[model samples]
Target: MRIAVVGTGYVGLVTGTCFAETGNTVTCVDIDQKKVDKLKGGTITIYEPGLDHLFLRNLKESRLHFTTNLAEGIKGAQIIFLALPTPPGEDGSADLSYVLGVSGQLGKILEAYAVIVDKSTVPVGTADKVRDAIGKNAKVEFDVVSNPEFLREGVAVDDFMKPDRVVIGTSSERAKALMQQLYAPFVRQGNPIVYMDERSAELTKYAANAFLAAKITFMNEIARMCERLDADVDMVRRGIGGDERIGKRFLFPGIGYGGSCFPKDVQALFKSAEDVDYDFRILRSVMEVNQEQKTYLVPKIKRYFGDLKGKHIALWGLAFKPNTDDIREAPALYIIEALLKEGARVTAFDPEAMENVKRVVGDKITFADNQYDALNGADALVIATEWSAFRTPDFEAMEGKLNKKVIFDGRNVFEGPQMKALGYYYESIGRRPVKP
Candidate 1:
């Protein structure tokens, strides 16, 4: 199969590279000259786990290519994937300018019959809009298909190589058959390829993300209750998670759900419903709760020390979650802002995300060389993201470095009983606070 993937961002890069790995000739097109040049020079841009190996292998084998010119990239492509960005607008709706703009250009240069796949997460009916955009100037016939991606940042390569299910939305039989043939190698394990109309496929991505966001928010709510009622959230989680009806995934409570997808998709879906005069009350609540949950640890930290005017706090973890360097809506940023406003100086550490956070916050906070280095001279410790390294640490070293044996764990990485035995004042989400 010959394929062209537009907008070589996270999704586009992964999509093109993974397809090339499956023995397809893939050319990725991006408008940025520097990025295209970097990729062409054998430098992988993103820091996804296990992606660089596959990308380098494919690039080395000549199965993958990159180009700045769209026409050159899609010269003989049978399937052109529009993986452009649809960022949120001021009104909370998805801004479709990038996707539509590229579609218009594709209309003019499409030389032969092709299947244009909407690989980006767009609003419902975007396939029709894309088809119209292309139809305006296109001389040849093409089918616009909606095929939203369901890749998690850390494990995107695995998710793409072995998808649980493939949702393809196309009314045309030709486009459907082509998409099925393209995805056949992936879903060989009998994970169904769900075929539906364009609108449903577009909505499916948003629905899955929004539901996961709600589940996380609901657990955060339960954690709050457990804190007040003197009940342990871990025990409560175990009690409820045993039921088959409510599967145990996304049940762990933390500072909140934040990344590239949940916040943007929930807001967009709510706004989508609002456009038709419908009230999406649940989504609205999810938005509000998640916003508050991001900074849920701030109040606890403030109460621990009545006046944080000169306190030095050490923070561990900066990424939204582990195994990726993305920090789109990371709760750690919110916590940093709130602490700074309270006149507390912060030193933070993350294995992979410090450079990205440094770009955003600049000199507002100190970046540490390692987790223990951040703890040096700090009055208390705060765990924001649950990176694997932070799960177990040398408590003696932590006790020796910190000015005081105080910890605020947002991710509940350490057991309360252990912290109690260690004689450190520890507080975590939905669990009893350990008092030394």
Candidate 2:
């Protein structure tokens, strides 16, 4: 198979590299010359786990290539994947300019019959719009298919290599057959390649992300109730997670859900509902609650210290989650902005996300070389992202660096009993505080 993937972002890069890994010839196209140059020079741009090896191997083996020219990139490709961005617009609807603009361009250049796949997460009617865009200038026959990606940030490579189920949206029998052949190697484990209408396939991606966001918000609400009623959320989570009805995943109560997918998808779904004159009440509440939950720790910090004007705080973790250096809508950014507004100085650390945070908030908060370095002369230590290294730390080393033995943990990294035994002031979500 000869394939061309446009817009070499996270999803595009992973899709191209993984497809090439399955012995298909893939040429990835990007508008940015510098990014294309970087990919050509053997540097994998994104920080996905296990992606580097595959990317490098495929590149070295001559199975993968990069180019800035879209026309040249898709010269002989059988399938063209549009993995472009659909960032939320001012009105909270997905801005489809990038996807539509590229689709229009692809129309003028395509020479043969090819399958055009919408690999980006888009709205329900985007496929029809794309088909119209291409049909305007295309002289040859081509099929536009909606095939939204379901890859998670950290484990995208594995997700692509071994998808549990591949949902493909196309009405054309010829297009469906080509897609089935292209994805046959990936679904050898009997994972069904579910075929549906284009609109349903488009809605599936939004629905999945919205539901996960709601689930996380619901647990955060439960965590709030647990705190007020003097109950432990951990116990409640475990008790309910055991039931098959409520899965264990996405049940951990945290500050909130923040990433490229969940926040944008939830908002887009809500906007899509409004466009259809339908009120999505639960999604509306989920958005409201998630915004409040992101800064859920600010009030606690203020109550603990009467004046935050001169407080020095240590914060651990900056990424939205672990194993990836993505900081889009990260909860730590919300906390840092709130703390800075209160005139408090913060020093923060994350194994992989600090550089990204530095780009967004330059010198607003000091960046520490290590987690303990962040605690030097700090009034309290606040854990934000729950990075693997922050899970277990040398408490003695942490104690020696802080001005006071106090900790405010957002990810609930430590238990009340352990903090009590350690003789430190510790506060966590939905758990009893331990006072020194």
Task: List candidate 1 segments past 4 Å from native.
Answer: none
Q: Using Cα atoms with residue i matched to residue i, what is each candidate's TM-score against the true structure? A: 0.99, 0.99
lDDT (Cα, 0-100) at 228 in candidate 2: 95
Candidate that would win on lDDT: 1
Off by over 4 Å in 2: none
Task: Record all residue pairs in model 1 with backbone atoms less than 3 Å apart, i.e. clashing.
Answer: none
How would you encode candidate 1's per-residue C-alpha lDDT over 93-148 as one tens digit per residue?
Answer: 99999999999999999999999999999999899999999999999999999999
TM-score, cand. 1: 0.99
In candidate 2, list every pair of residues with a backbone clash.
none
Report lDDT (Cα) of residue 290, candidate 2: 97
Window of ten residues with lowest summed lDDT in model 1: 301-310
Cα shift from native, residue 290, model 2 (Å): 0.4
